[model samples]
Every structure is written in C-alpha cells, then in structure tokens.
Target: MKNTILILFITLLSVSCKKEPQYLVKIEGKQLPISAEIASDKTIEDFILPYKEKVEAEMNTVLSYTPKDLVRIDGKLESSLGNLMADLCFERANPVFNSRTGKNIDFAMLNFGGIRAGITKGDIKTINAFNLMPFENSLVVVEMTAEKVTELAKYLIAQNKAHPISKQLNLIVEANEYNLTIHNLPLDDSKTYFVLTSDYLQNGGDNMVFFKDPVKLFKLDYKVRNSIIDYFTEIDTIKVELDGRFTKEN
Candidate 1:
C-alpha cells in the first residue's frame, strides 16, 4: 500500500511539473531603415578593408573588349547579349561534353532574364561576367524528344521574348505553326536531340517545363559564369549579332 501511494505521488508530481505551452498573444513589427545618417564603425571598416580591396582588384581585371554595347533589349525574338551568352556557353561546354560522352550538343538555350546586365562598349572586366550571370547555375545537357522540342518552340513563340538560343537553331514562328531546324536540319522524331542549357532551365525554372523530364541528362559540372569568364579570357574581342536565329512572321 505504501509503495502504491508513493507511485501515485510521483505521477501527480510529474503532471504538476509539466510546463504549459506558451501562446503568442500579439505580434509587433519594427521598421529598421538603413541610411547614410548612421555612422560607419571604424574598427569594422578597418577589418574589412583588405578583403574589399582584394575583391575590387580582382573584379576590375580586364578580360576582353566589346566594340558595341551588348544589351538584351536590342532586338525582338533575340538579342546580341543573348546570342553571346548562348554561343559562348556552347563553345565552352561542348568540348567538355564531347570529351566525356563522345556526343555533341545539338544546340544551346537560355532564358532572357538569365542575362542580368549589359556589356558596355569598352574593356570587359571580370566584374562584367559576374554582373551578367550572378547565379551559380551550372551547365547541363538534356536529350529531349521531338515532342518536347516542339513544346519548347511553342513556349518561345508564346512568350515572344529574346530567350538565348545558339546559332545551331533556326526557329521561325508563323501564326499557328512554327518551323525549327537544329544544325540546319529539321528535327527528327525518331531520334532525340541534345540541348545545352543551365541547370536552372533543365529543372523547369522560369516555367520552361519542356526542359523537365528529358530523355537523358548530362551534367558538365561547369558553372555558366565560369564559362563566360573563360570565353572572355580566351577571346580578345566580343562580337555578337542577331543573324536571324529566331524570327516571327506577321
């Protein structure tokens, strides 16, 4: 009987000691605005000065030169910057892909918004590559079916934006129908086409669903920004133009 009473007492004690859940009765938010009125901390600035200087020096290093400004808004259905981005990525990524799998990428595609900034008509610096593609998107090649390729063309025509496409592709949108040629040949339904693009697009980013669920995926493990940097380093001048890669008929 004594042991039973002790057990009951312990159980009661445990129940009584249990903490109740805390509830939030109200929520208050405060606005903190950053302005020049706030004084800089000298100690903090001194500590960061070396790193800042190093980064600035590295970013300011010249890579290549551009005779004219490369802007994404320069053309309809395609842009000079878009052309450069797609072509350079292909040029850089194809060799790597071919070396590994012995297969050549049929074409390259990238979203318009991927080009973050324009290259001014002057010396191209390392910072220009960073400014152009700030994301850590990697290069990936997807083998897509003819149906998926058609969907891709439809999406491009519907959006009617300057999505970056390599010179290998010739997309002509005419009313309800469109004509697409890869490497100057029409898309074959019996065979899959390999397309070079960033991992972001391969995962259906920016509503590019056609890129998702491809027949085969080849990851190059190369970053798009690095490709741009490498391309700039190798080339003395950057010249890109819209050579009727994509067109629309009225």
Candidate 2:
C-alpha cells in the first residue's frame, strides 16, 4: 500500500512539470529592399492590372481648363485660388441648404491651410481637384446670431491670415474698428445668418471657436472635393482673380 501511494504522488508531480508554460522569443530587424531581380508573381499582377487601368483612366480625365495659374502665396490677404474655392463652395451649397432649411447661406469661410496645391494654367483633370483639397471634409452650415458674426470678424482680424472668404463678405480692417458687410449690407445684431463652412471648421478647427454652439447646424452631406469636381465639370473655362475682398487700411 505504501509503495502504491508513493508511485501516485510521483506521477502527479511529473504531470505538473510537463504542463509548465513557455514564453515566446522576439527578433527584430530592418526592412530589406525589394530588388527587380525578384521573380514576378504572374497571378498577383494579373489580378491588379484591371483596377490599375481604371484608376489611371479616371485620374487622367479632363474636367475643365484654367486660363491662368491660381496659386496660394504667403503674406497676401487673398489669393485667386482661395477666392475661387470659397465662391464655388458657397455657390454649390447655397441652393442645397436653402431647399432643405428654407434659409439662404449668407457667406462661406475656409482655412488657408486647407488649400493643398495650386492649379496650373492648363487642362484641369479630376486628379487636380483631389490634389487641391485632399481632406474628405463635408459641407456644413452654421446658423449663428449677429453677435457671433461679430466674433467671427474679430477672429479674422486677429488672425490676419489669408483665409478664404466668399464674395458675399466685404471686410475692411481699420486701426481699432472693423467694417464688415454681408451681401452688401450691414450686420444686424438681431438677425441670424447661415454661414457655409466645412464640418472641421464648424467643430472649432483653426481656433474658430465662434462657430461652436451655433443656433442651428446643418450637414449638407456634400464633400468639398465633390463640390469642386462638380463645379469644374459644369464650367468650361475656370477664371479666378484676386479682387481685394478682404482689405486692411490704417
């Protein structure tokens, strides 16, 4: 009986030892370059060829033509490219917002940093639109009171950067006071204005806190990139110029 009990104990100890856990060993190395001498995988190439061809064809499709090059330059209160984009956004989004909410878009505002690239003086392709506004920001309308509109103007004056504003706005910065007009009229402190901008800006991007807590927020479900593409497709020739929409005087 003793010998049988001892044999059972030894068996249990052996099973527990066998069940001990093991750890994984890690090895790290730098990525190696892929050489042209590598054998091409025929199956993979055949699978990707059709998709590649379709993408190339779409990107190369001409949408419109620009008479002159529109560039985003530094230290300028406004640029041809910025004016063109802001005007296009307002034009495209106004009708949509009006139809949905029965209110017209008073003006449009966009950040200067958002304009990625300049449009060359030549045939404008779909790829150019994508390159200009790479972000997938959607169009949004913020209904703000007259007080908030004043805040908006102040923010612009303080920034003193070449941000894009629609033609509807005529802002003149004086030494201590700012003269702002929307649609060629003075801002009414009791009125509510529908301002068209990107969802990013509406959410306080670029320190535009005045856009926050608006009276009404309308999402247009329209991508800014798509709006540009639509505008280019509709117009045969794209003409843009700096018209001194926002000016400073001491």
Candidate 3:
C-alpha cells in the first residue's frame, strides 16, 4: 500500500512539472518546395543529390571501359584539332556584335589545352563538360577595334604549336603552320570591338595579351560552365557535336 502511494505521488509530480514546448511557434509563410528541374516525365533527384549521383555513376562507368575505348577517347582529342579551336575560341574570345557600331565579329577564339576531355563516341554528359572547362571562368565581352584585333592576330601567329590554352581566337594550321584569313585580316584601330570571354583570359592569365581593355562593355552573371550546360542542352537533341571548325590542311 505504501509503495503504491509513493509511485502514484511521483507520477503526479512528474506530470505536473512537464513543461510546454519552448518553441515560439510562428505561422510564417509556407511553400510547397517547388524546384528548378529538367521538366520531363523522367524521375530526377534534387540538384545536389542527383548531380552527385550522376557524377558518381559516370565516374564508375568511365573507369570500367576497355583500353580500346580509352584509346578512342584520347585519340579523338589527339587526332583532331577541335581541342585547339575549343581551347582558343571559347576562353577569352566570346564576341557580341553591337548593331550601333556595325562591327562584325568572328567565331569566339579559345585554345586546345583548355579542352581536357573527349566525347567518347557517345552522348556527352554533364561530367564531360565539367572536365572540359574545369576552371572558374565566365564569358566577358570586351569592346575592341579592328586595329587591336590585327595586333591580337599578330601575337597569336607568333605562338606556334608550343602553346596550348587560347586567350582570344581559334587558330587552324596548315601543316603545323597557321595560314588563315581571320588572323591576317585588317582591323580598324578606331572601331570599338566587343569580345566575349572569361575573366581569366581578360586578366591576361591565358597569355592573351590583347585582353587589355581600353574599355569593358558587359559582364555575364552566369558561370561559363552553366552557360555551356545551357548551350549543350539546347543544341536540338544533339548533346555533343563536333563541327571540325579547326581542320587540317596540307
């Protein structure tokens, strides 16, 4: 009887002392967790999660490939000149022509070493693009002129095959020597030219000395990688296409 009374007393005391939740619960606005997505019937994980998983899967898949496939991947880069074009054209040479100036621009110049991987004879994946650029670069269009362009070409011609990364323009060679029109064309020193490129090239880190801006017109808020991703995504179902803009000539 005494034990029962003691237990009952303790239970009643515990119940009486129990505190309410300490949270100052406020009914703030709520959202349904909508997210930016690929917009498809296919299932997709979240940005960080799915991105992580797909990368892991590709990593594993690439690792298991045969030596023959590996050779093709490396061969595609070695045997072709796209590496040179992509390297020089895309790096610091993104051009946006202004209608006000009537200044026509050519293909964005980037160099080969900047292109770090091959397309592997299959659909290019997100990881493939990442491996290509791999740097924290953004597209910057700088206002330049025909004279500055001419000067830029002269500098490019002097580099020869010893150089790799592109600073302003893609150079195609005829027998390990470049004999091209874009590089030799006359440039007007008086006309303002807008060149699109990454900040890295603008800062002159890519050995592109022409990035010296008398004036900078616009800067992109997007990363170069994201821009590449968006660009590849919209290429009409062809995830990766090599036009061979950089061709071999005898």
TM, every model = 0.86, 0.89, 0.51
lDDT of 3 by residue, 1-250 (tens): 9999999999999999999688776879876765676354443444467788766885443221112111113232122324333343453234323433445444354444555665454465667567767887776666666666666555655543323323223445565455434434434456665555567776776688687763655665556666656555544333223333333455
| Model 1 lDDT per residue over 74-168, tens place | 89999999999999999999999999999999999999989999999999999999999999999999999999998998899889999999999
Quantify all predictions' global Cα lDDT against the true fold: 0.95, 0.92, 0.51
**Which residues of candidate 1, in runs, are more than 4 Å off?**
1-33
User: Which run of 10 residues does model 3 get worst, by summed lDDT?
Assistant: 63-72
* TM-score, cand. 1: 0.86
Backbone Cα, N, C clashes tallied per candidate: 0, 0, 22
Name the regions of candidate 2 deviating beyond 4 angstroms.
1-29, 35-40
Off by over 4 Å in 3: 1-106, 162-186, 236-250
Expressed as tens digits, the lDDT of each residue in 78-175 for candidate 2 is 88889999999999999999898788999999999899999899999999999999999999999999999999998888888889999999999888
Quote the positional error of residue 66 for candidate 1 in Å.
Answer: 0.1
